[model samples]
Each structure stands twice: as structure tokens, then as C-alpha cells.
Target: MKPISWCSAVIKVERRAHAVHTLRFPAHLPTSSESRLPSVTSDNEIVQNIIAQAFSAIINLKHLFLLGQNSQPASIKLSTLASCTFSLCSFAGQVSGDLGIQEQLDFLLKHPTIEYWVPTEPFLRSVNSFPTNILPNLRQTVLVRPSLMKALGGRPIESLMILFIDITHSRAVEYTHGSLGPDWSTIDIISNLSRAAPNLKILTLGSLIKDDSVITAENQQSLVDAVARFCHLKILVLNTYMCALQKHTDEDPDPENPLEHSVAWEGRSPAQARQVATQFMTACPSLRRLSFPDTGPSPTNSLTYILSGTKAKLDGFYIIDNSGWWLR
Candidate 1:
């Protein structure tokens, strides 16, 4: 069937399709399945056949959910589903390859008919490698890596209303390794993402930051600069280091007093962390809600801290503690 003709039929009988093409796996599959391996392949084949045949006949899919639990390929080439969600509900490890994921994004971008997308891991992992034109029609996307932000580069998907990134330890490592290749650094990760998804309204990042010491003055400036650039950001969630207390070493510049946290900070006491926070609060005038948990101390020199310069558009602050709640 031609794509157009199939579309019309889909429009004619769209209401009945919520259950037609759905695939659900049974709760229990034998763990000791040495003899029934063919069943796994047969199951995937059945799913693919159902989707292919259904698309050809109905021409329009209202909702589609493709989930994989057996590490098998969950392939769907339908270019224009009204709503779709793919959950690799239980993928034990990494999944790879570009062809299957690329096709889905291509279809999702080309057709304005699609309204939502929730792709699973391994498939979602390939977003960095996809071309810029994919997801042009996407309005809401739930992604698992920063590389997915590359797909949003150049404002192609400015229509995006929501974006969720699941940057767990393994996921963060995959993004860093995949996009940065070998020349990877925490600063590189922050800089590239800031530029790639400038218009993002809501953003979340989760990482297993191993060392707070990695956040030096230079990198900290990079982070602050990046935040300053994105004026439209309304919500930012990051799971990273708060601060690092320096430890003394053998070869001290001053033998009388080895480098302590205070010495390492160039005479700036740990209390200055609160001063830095105050500077941050002052920088973003349009900021509505600011929250940083235990990142450092509350801003010191509160009297000198100017919220008046905030353009009066500020609502409240979400300090690492219960400041926001207590004020309410």
C-alpha cells in the first residue's frame, strides 16, 4: 500500500487500533530454556509481522509501544504514528547498532502527525549518531543521554516542550565515551551540551561524579558561563558534586603549613562557597526557582547580596536545604 493510501485508511478506522498492534510479553519465560530457543526468534518474528501487516492495512497508528526484554531487536519502521512509546522495559546491558533507531527518528521527524516519543535504551543510545533533521516534528521527547541533545541542535526541534535525560553512571559514561570518543573531560561534556540545546525549557542531568576535585575554578567558570547563555531555561536538574575539601600532600609549598582546603582555595575559606552561591543567585535575573542541595553553604554576605538586580522577576530560591519550603 502507498503511504498516502495507508494514511487515509488509518484515519477512517483509527479509534479501534489502540489494541490492534500492541505487543505484550508474558510475565514468566523459562530461565533454563536451552531447548526452546527458537521460540524467542519466533516471538520477535511474530511481533514484526503484526506491525508490518497492521501498518499496511490501517495506514494510521494512533499509539505504538515497542518494548524489548530479551535483548532482541525491537524494530518498527512506521514513519507516522499519532503517538508512540518504546520501552526496553528490562534491558540488562548495552544495546548497539544505528539502522533501527535512525529509521524511527527519521519517521518521527518527517511526520508532524506524531505527538510524543519515549524510546528505550540502546535505541536511544544511537541519538548522537543521527542526523540533525530527525525529530523536527517532535514536541515531547524523553531521552537518556546528552548526545540526544545533538539531535536538537540548530533549533530544529524548538517545538520541544519537555526533555528528560537519564544520565545514570553507565548512561553518562556512554554519552561521554560516544560523543567525546577518547578526548573526554567533564568540561567538554558541559560545554557541548550547553551549546547544543540552548532553547531547552526543562533539562535534567544525572551523573556519578567520582571526584569533586575535578571542578576547578576554570571548569566552574565554564559551567556558570553555560548557564548564563541559556536564557529560556526554566528548570535545571543536575546530580553532580557539591564541593571538595582539599587534603594535604607531602611536597607542600609552605612546609610550615601544608595545603589544606582553605590554603588550596587561595585563602578563600570554605565559607566562601556561600559567597559563590550568592553570586550565582545574583547572575540570573530571570531565574524563577533556584535550588542547589548541599552543593555548598548558603550565600555569605547576605546583606551585600542583591536580589533587587534580579529584574524583580525572581520568585523564590531552592537552596540545598529546606529554604524554599520553610519560606512557604
Candidate 2:
């Protein structure tokens, strides 16, 4: 929490707790350390102490955004998070485990009047499968995480977007796929969706990567399996990167070189993309339309693929056609 913003916001609303409805943590929550990293126990206590005190002054709060995944407090419910004893406890710093998605869910469950929930990494990382029946009024606002999807078992959701990226992970493009780039993180989430939101109408999923070749049509049968999990998934959008074919040699050019062989890669053709799209359409008979990442010979607007008979046509519709609805 930035002290300047906290001081200003508190000064403005210190006497008017009712005036504060939204509680959001910024992109970076600073601490006593120069690195500003999380997991610093003493530093985190200061943050937790400050946070625990605020809820008393914020009884009418609606939106509280926390997006960390450190050590979470065992008793993470509203009571412990806002109490004075929790503030002074030796283990007080462990409130919501570094930007807990679980904490946000607890907040959502407690406050039903909250209309819009912001996106955070923990929103997708939550595991406790809280039931939907607890608050029937929240039917439309359910934010789904992979493991948390089980909580929605036998429930329904209209729209959803699941995203995965090696953009900043150990498997990023800079890591060069480490080993054949077989680590697609979207699998388990897809499987959860299949059994969880059986009536999901519109869906979008992406495994954004630098080298699209890492997930070409050749090794995508598992993805097809995951997609088949949804009982009634209709309009679907797939965001992916298409790779151009590349070949490398294992030539040890230098005779005195200690190292032996070399390594390189592969790609996905437009034909391959079409094959995979058709696979998805076949996997989900309920699917009326689907969009795939474009394979590029030209950098033109790569369009969506919709079911036509047993195959998919590539240039008519677009997934973002309803982009305006996202603002609502």
C-alpha cells in the first residue's frame, strides 16, 4: 500500500466509512525493503496491521482487490482480517498470502452488493470450491478459477475467459521451450470448465506464448480433449500464436569444441490451424462458432472459424465482435 494514497484516501473518508465501497491494492504494494518484494514477514506485518484497521472504518466496502500468492492466513475470513488481535499477532503478516485470490473470494461472498469484480492473478489461482447456493443473487458474478471451478459443479455460467502465458514464467520464449515446450498450463482449467459451467455460452481461452510453434497442431490432441469437457460451450474464441517452420542442424562446426550437438525448432501452417479448428468443432457438437489464432503468410486480420457441416470456415466472423459488452 502506498502511504501517500492511503493517507489521502483515509483523510477524505476517515469519518465517512460509508463513502468507501471499493478497496483495491495497486499494481505494486511497497514495503520497507529496497527490492519491494513480498514475503518479508516484518514488512508485511506493517501492511497487514494497516489493512486490519481499515475494515472497521469500512463496513460498507464492496470491492477489495488483492493479487498476491504468498503465505495466506489460515483463518482468512473477514473476522480475523479486520480484528485488533489479528493486527498484533506474531503471525499477523500472513493475511491473504501475498495477494490471495481466496481472500477476494471471501470478500465477494461476504458482500453481495458488489457489482463488478476486477481481474487479478489470484482470481484464477483460487482452489476452495465455495458453493453457489450460499448467495443465489450472485449467479451472474461468479469468477471462475481452475481448481475453484469444482465449487461450481452442476452450476452454470454464461461467459468466461481463461488465459495462460509463458510470458513471464520459467517456460517463456527466453527459456526456449526448455524441453519441446510441452507445458501448456490451460489443460486443467479446461477440464474443470467442462464439468463446472455446463451451460457456458461464450468462452475465450489463450495460451499466449512467444514461439507459437511450442503448441502446434501436432501435439494439440490433449487440448482437443480439454475442449471437449464443456457440456454446452457455444461461441468460442481461441487466442494463439502461429509459428513458421524452422530447421536446425546438430553440426559441431569447431573440432576443438567441448560441446557436441545443437538444438532448434518447428511451426504451424495455415493448413494445420484449419485441422485443429475442425478438431475443436468435432469435439464440441454444441459449438456453433469458434475462433483460432491466425497462421500468417500475410499479416492481415486473422478471422474466426465457424462450424459448417463437419468442417470450419476461416474468414467470416471474429471473436471480439462483442468487445463492447466487456465494458458493461
Candidate 3:
């Protein structure tokens, strides 16, 4: 591979295309089971040195995107890149061992010009706690995991404009029986965003879990109230399953009164779902775009109400129901 001499660079080790004008370095470490394990120590040092050289080569870089899998470079390797002046820095893919979440945040903080800090994929093992100090120049953020919500708590991010909370990967396990779902405290963290990120223009909350372990009605209402606080929000994407109460079934039941034998499901009805959506639209008067999940024959009366009553001149209203039946 020839040395890169461009002012803007996008280096991807993986096949997938992520960010443009991004600088990605390979951080793969050989395991003991692999034949190259004997030379792993030397190989890592070489990779680090190459990364350092590459960082030095980019003289006038403005935006940087780092992509790696399974492992991340040590603090020293990261420090090399931090030395450069960049306005945006993004770390994508699974990061474990040496460079944990705190260290990654530290690296971002070191760069004084960084206005956007995006960490994609399963970066943190868990999003329980976060640094207290605010990133002075940070204006945009993408918290792809629900756990990352902890990062926004308490601190005032007055400049933050775009925020994305994608809990699809983390919410999968919560759907199983006996699982209580994600920490309810995360909701408080989000609610605080109204004051913290008062200027937030866009907010997206998506869940990829196919099962029925949906957010409780109480929490959903709380989320609506919290989001309503973002007075400047223009776009909102809410992809979640409404809680449905499971019915009790037995060998025999009265045909005359089936309602007598029915039991409450664990999830909420379509009406409750509409109520939550309506609250968000009503709260954020500046809202122009609204997106909801396409969950089969779910009622959309709430959306209709928003369109009829609100005078925000909506840019678009979308339903992302991937199920082929919706298309038919």
C-alpha cells in the first residue's frame, strides 16, 4: 500500500464503507490459537508505528474516523493520533481490553478542536457510567447504544444538536423472559438532556429486537415527557414495540364470554402507543419530521391527529416496518 499524502483521508480495514474522510487503522491482534501468535508482540508494535507515521503524514486533516474490531490500540498509539488537530473524531466497531470506554473518551477530550465525537457499533462493554466533564466544542453525538445515555447525564451540552440513541443491539437480550429490560435510570439520563443539550435538533430512538420485551408504558410516557423538553427538536425517530398484555390460556373456556377468561398481556395496546407519539409531537412545536416503527396492522390514529392539528409544516412522516406484508 502506498503512503497516503492527502489532506482528507478515509482508511478502512474492513470491507464495509463507514465514514468518508475517515482514518482507520488495523488493530487486529493475533490469538494463541493462530500460527502468527508467536510474533504478535512484534506485529502490534509495527502496526502502532505505522499508525503513528500515518497520523503524522496527514498535515491538514480536519475530520478523522477510526475503525477497528475486537481490540483497540494502547493509550500511546491513541495519543499519537490525538496530537493531530481535527474537528471531528469517530471510533467504530467493538473495542475491548486495553482501550476501554473511559480511555476512548479521554482520547477524544485531548483533542481541543473536536466538535463531534461519534462511537459506532459495540464500543463499550456496558454503558453504566460516563465522564462528568463536558466536551466544550462537542456539537453532535451518536450514542448507538442505550447504555451510552449515561454520558449525557448531569453535564450541560448546550451546543449538542444531533443525538441518536440506538438500543437495538443491547435491547435484544432484554426481550427474553425473566429479563427486566434496560436500566430505567437511563430514562432520567435522557430527561436531563432537555437542560443539558437544550439545542438538540434531532433525536432518534430505535430498537432492533424482534421479540415483545418493549419499554413499559410508564417509561414510554416518561421518555415522551423528557423529549418534549427539547423545544428545538425538529426530527424524531421512535422505533419501538408497544407492550402487549399476554392472555392466559387453558384447556377449556366459556364460548359465551371469552372476555371472562382473557388475561392482560405484558405489552400495551395500539392506543397507548399513539398517545406517546402524540405527546412528543405536541411537546416539540418545532418538530417537522416524525418516524415510527411499522409493526404490522398497528393503529396510526395518533399520527393522523398530529398531521391534522399541528401547523409545523412537516417535512416527512415515515414508518419503517421491514416486514414484507406492509409492502403488499
- Name the best candidate (by lDDT): 2
Clash pairs (backbone) in predicted model 3: 168-208, 243-267, 243-268, 244-267, 244-268, 245-265, 245-266, 245-267, 246-265, 246-266
Question: What is the C-alpha lDDT profile of model 1 across 32-86, one tens digit per residue?
Answer: 2433336757744544444444454443334444333333432343432223443
| C-alpha RMSD in Å of predicted model 3 compared with the true structure | 10.7
Worst-scoring 10-residue span by lDDT in model 2? 85-94
Model 2 vs. true fold: TM: 0.48
Which whole-number lDDT from 0 to 100 does residue 236 have in model 1? 53
Model 3: CA > 4 A from native: 1-21, 24-38, 69-96, 100-106, 120-134, 144-171, 175-192, 208-224, 242-279, 296-328
How much RMSD separates candidate 1 from the native structure? Answer: 12.1
* Candidate 2: tens digits of C-alpha lDDT, residues 1-328: 4643573466457666557655544323554564354657865665555555655656555445433323322223344353321111001111333455555455445554433333333334444555564333322332323444456455445666644432113132221222112443555446656676777777776443434324444546777787787767788776554342222323322233211111211232334445556778898888878775453422223446777678765544233332222222
Task: Estimate the lDDT of model 3.
Answer: 0.45
**Model 3 lDDT per residue over 1-328, tens place:** 3222221232333212232245543334333344343576765565456556556555445565433432333123455465554444433333334556666678656664555565544343344555555455555665434434445544333333222222223222322211123443334545755665667776654453433335465566666677777878876665554442122223233244332233421232434333445566777677656655424323231122233355322222344432211011
In order, what lDDT does every prediction score? Answer: 0.41, 0.47, 0.45
RMSD of each: 12.1, 12.8, 10.7
Best by TM-score: 3
